[model samples]
Target: MKLLLTSGGVTNPTIRAALTDLLGKPIEECHALCVPTAQWGHPMCGPASVRGLLAAEPSFRHLTGLGWASLGALELTALPSIGRERWEPWVRGADVLLVDGGDATYLGHWLRKSGLADLFPSLPDTVWVGVSAGSMVMTPRIGDLFVEWAGAPDDRTLGVVEFSIFPHLDAFPTNTLEAAERWAADIGGPAYAIDEQTAIRVVDGHAEVVSEGRWFQLTR
Candidate 1:
């Protein structure tokens, strides 16, 4: 499996370069399916959220401006809502699955309810790019220690990755290195703390860190 789990979406040159490298192609030729299910977990999943996402164009413009293609938003909240027949092909055809972040529990619930988790293993060639909660849901669990930040507290996750990730370190309110360290100390297995400019890239079970900011890992 190939996964780029990030604290924030692509926002800096290092990350952009890492993504381009992961794809083994110029950013211009990539086709991404933006999964925004996480936004729904928040209180602003309506027009305001849409506008906010659109406003982030400047940050992701490296790809958008480079002739990269996108297929609107993929709402994975439910099977019928996303039209499995149509969206499934779109997801399979895309080179990258770009997932936004919000409540990890909510996103994981919908992903499983929609049967998307079952499909992940089939998309071996597709790069799974996750931002924050999007990244958290792929782990075995989202620790309760982070309840103050994640809003929801469901420990069950996709388990796509064996470890847990603590994102937005020092970026969001109440998020700090000390808090991340404490959370990791209590975790039963491996855990990592990633800042906005950092990402954890895992390929074929091997993990590597790509960052322009702070990040640390703890292992049991």
Candidate 2:
């Protein structure tokens, strides 16, 4: 599996360049599926989450013309309200899935409820690209942010990746390198603390740092 995990969003020129270089073409060459969390509501409703992905690509002019190429926005909110036959084709047609940052609990809840959690992994040819909260869901455990927001004692996650990924480390209070070390010690495997502009690309079972910031591989 080809993974393009970014720290924040694709709007940053450096981030976009790295992504384009990794994908071997301009940002417009790949089919982008923008999953925004603002539709879910406040706190998670930050525009920066998906602004980068949408701005970097030019193919997403309208919802109907998305299938042509470049980019598309898979409005998760529309899925539950619309008929499956009408929107399912777009979901299946995407070549790259880009998830925006948001509340991990809400993001996971909506993704599973929309029947996309299972569908995404099952797609044989699609590349998964996640930013911030989008990347957090791929792990086996959610971070303290989930606890602060949802207030469930334990973490709820999708378990797509063996370890948990901590994004926006420089901005979040609970995501320090020391905190990541503690989390790794308690959770087993490794915990990745990714700073702004940093990314960890996991292809198959291996992971390597691919951006300009710090990447801490913490373990017990």
Question: Please, what is the TM-score per model?
Answer: 0.87, 0.75
Cα-based lDDT at residue 93, candidate 1 = 79
Relative to the true structure, how large is the alpha-carbon lDDT of every model?
0.75, 0.64
- Cα RMSD, each candidate: 2.8, 5.0
Q: Write the per-residue lDDT of candidate 1 for residues 1-220, one digit (tens) a residue.
A: 4798998777688888878888888766778767777767766355565455544455444322334655455678656674678668877778887777777888888888787777888877788788888899899877775433344545667888889998988887778888877777777788988888899888888888899998888664
lDDT assessment of candidate 2: 0.64
Which regions of candidate 1 deviate over 4 angstroms? Answer: 44-46, 54-56, 59-67, 81-83, 145-153
Predicted structure 2, TM vs. truth: 0.75
Q: Report, for all candidates in order, the number of backbone clashes.
A: 0, 1
Give a tens-digit lDDT track for model 2, residues 74-183: 86766888867887788777667777666666677777777777676567556667776777777788655444444333666777777777776767777787777776
Return the lDDT, model 2, position 21: 58
